[model samples]
Target: MLRITPRILAVACIASGLITAACASYAPTPSSDLAGTSWAVQSIDGQPTSARSPSVEFAAEDRISGAGGCNSFSGVYEAANGAISVRALGRTEMACEGGVMLQEDAFFAVLDGAERYARQQDRLVITADDGRALVLAPL
Candidate 1:
């Protein structure tokens, strides 16, 4: 026969609480600060990037510089309270492989629409106003 005593119930509750606290400690927390951070594009809109991936550096003075997979680009960005906006982006016009150019175009489009960003663990995800997302990994 089994008994359901108050002591057993209390021990079970404590065990559950301890387990939850352990898990919360290990969970990924949102990262702070974007300046001086650099990352290489891993994917855009859930599509994996190629070997020559676009890269970005959140430089000082709200300036951002990166390779657009085919061309280098620079722009100014504003980030505050989890919201982000990229603007005035300009890129070199050098020609590249067709696939690479297409990828660059898509990347630029997403940047143009960027509205928010989050750094989860090692991944930095920039999401657009239209729900498109760019996933990047530390460089």
Candidate 2:
């Protein structure tokens, strides 16, 4: 047999209410402004790197178009709420010497394996499942 007490019932109700409120607060909110806009790479892991602050533009057709330093690149983008992914990227080959080429190569390599995206204030962050993150800001 089980007995119900007022104190126990009150605690249970309070716990349930707190859990519900926590879940609601943590839920991600989708931003329509993020779509169909251009953004520029700002900093990586809080370090300043101007190697190539390329711009990315999202399209209504689920595509992402951007300039990879000296070359142009395009890819497919899929996003929902707080999650975003880019796939099947293709880029033009243009000769760029010095640090620009190196930066472009690094940037493209990161994008090729990008698995998730997050927005923080005015910055957009792309990340891999391994925890590596890249930050970008509005252009």
Instruction: Give TM-scores for every candidate, taking all chains together and pairing residue i with residue i.
Output: 0.76, 0.68
**Model 1, span 1-139: residue lDDT tens:** 8898999999999999999988785543323388888999999999999999999998767888999998999999988778999999998999999999999988999999999999899999999998999999999
Model 2 lDDT per residue over 30-127, tens place:
33346677888765445455756767887766778898778899988777766677888989988987777767776776677677788888888887
Error of 1 at 90 (Å): 0.9
lDDT for predicted candidate 1 compared with the true structure? 0.91
C-alpha lDDT of all candidate models, in order: 0.91, 0.75
lDDT of 1 at 86: 93
Q: TM-score of model 1 relative to the true fold? A: 0.76
**Highest TM-score against the true fold, candidate:** 1
Candidate 2 — worst ten consecutive residues by lDDT sum? 25-34
Clashes of each: 0, 0
Most lDDT-accurate candidate: 1
